[model samples]
Target: MSVPVNGGDLVVSRLSSAAPSAPTAIALHGITGNGWAWLPVAAGLFGRMSLWAPDLRGRAASRLVGPPYGLGTHADDVIALMDHLELERAVLIGHSMGAWVGSLVAARHPDRVSSLVLVDGGLGTAMPSWVDPDLFMYAVLGPAIQRLGMTFPSPADYLAYWAFHPGLGPTLAGPTGHLVRHYLTRDLVQERGGWRSSCVLDAVRADGSALLDDEEVLTSPQASIGHGIPVSLLWAPRGALNQPMGLYGGAWPPWRPLPEGITAERVPDANHYTVIFDPPAVRQVVSRLLAAAAR
Candidate 1:
């Protein structure tokens, strides 16, 4: 399903439930990810909640969405999606950059959200002064963003490429690999020589810049209204590269004081990618998401 917005129609992937009262959940993927990345989570839901994961505004099927890319714009798109769906309120679930955008949605339109689940993201990174401000995006995203420029000879080749990702490779080879394989396949588009990811490189950069420059988006909602909506931050200890430290480094997002209604909990043995792609981690995320909705 898609919600028509100014730039373009926001594409969404849905896993429906038979139960009439199944709570609706809108999921947002990571910066370089697409809606299908939530496949494992959807499957884990087992029809408990109707889940909809959008391609956001500039990734996958929504790649053609024009400029004005940032968390705020993304949040607006989400709200438009809700309006189109005629859903008065829903549970907001986000991962990585999506989590940041979800935070904005809950803060700006608290009445439209029941609760929020931030998986392995949504916290501000503690960038050091030594790190060049201009290079912070490159520093944080590293190869994940760099992969946009890469090309693979064929769909099979592209599948093999992600099968080798440092942190996600193993998960792509595991139980839910087929689901992730579908997600990766959707990310591919045939070019002259090979297939390249559908994500717009410039959009990714703009999003990274927003996250790096804005502290209030992450801390502001809490700073002001306290977001009355229940929020949970499920973090992973391992980074995107399978490193010991995650996005917040060795320490968590408590570089500053935490907000009143939000709480953080660490997910053991899961990295940035594994936190969703891996089966056990997917189950954990879904359970937490349901719990947040029940709140």
Candidate 2:
């Protein structure tokens, strides 16, 4: 459902198994993705936790607002949503860009977040200075943009396009294909003749520079909050972005070293995307977070 916050509508989807008393886990998806991306993991964990996944502004179903789509703005949006829902404190789980925003929220608004599960991100690493934001956007968001550009002749065609994503290929081949198609088609708009993606590409491009700046800010020591809250960092072992041979050269950022209080876990035999979507992998990370929170 859409809730008005900061002059913009936040699109939030809640998944619960039986009752309202279930522990709530707030999830955040990466760039070019939305709340739907978390459904698989949410379903697995919903038996024990009520999951609330929201599409951030400028993406998916969320309403696009003013400029400065940096970490601070995204974190504030989350806090506003938490207040609207009257959630005193909830576990915050974020992936990729969402992880960065989650870190900012944990650091700035400590009381609102009880614990953090950073899936395949939030190692506090900085991108190199030479990389241009536009180029980075194309590389990172290319697959999603390509899916958006297609004019599917039929529902099957659209499903075919989605099933081919390298990240989802193996998982989408059988029964899981049905699940993936359901979520993808749920967001498609039927125009005069064909299907169109609901995501706003222009709005996503508008804040390209801001995303880069936010990454830099996150890597800075100033963004660090001293050791009190527990943080769980889940890193992808085979992701293109974090691969040893890639641009960053597998080096962790100097400014944002693993804090003394945070626990880090590396997901073996998975890329950035699968680390979150794969059921077993996701459960492993969630188990770690729950265990850490218990301590």
Best by TM-score: 1
Q: Could you list the CA RMSD of all candidates, in the order they appear?
A: 2.3, 3.6
Which parts of model 2 are misplaced by more than 4 Å? 17-21, 63-68, 128-130, 148-150, 174-176, 206-208, 215-217, 220-227, 240-257, 292-295
Q: Which ten residues in a row have the lowest lDDT in candidate 1?
A: 248-257
Candidate 2: lDDT of 128?
Answer: 77
Model 1 misplacement above 4 A: 125-134, 220-225, 249-257
Model 2 TM-score (2 dp):
0.83
lDDT string for model 2 (237-271, tens) is: 55533343222123343223566656666666556
Query: What is the Cα-based TM-score of model 1?
Result: 0.92
TM-score of each: 0.92, 0.83
Per-model C-alpha lDDT, please? 0.81, 0.66
List of clashing residue pairs for candidate 1: none
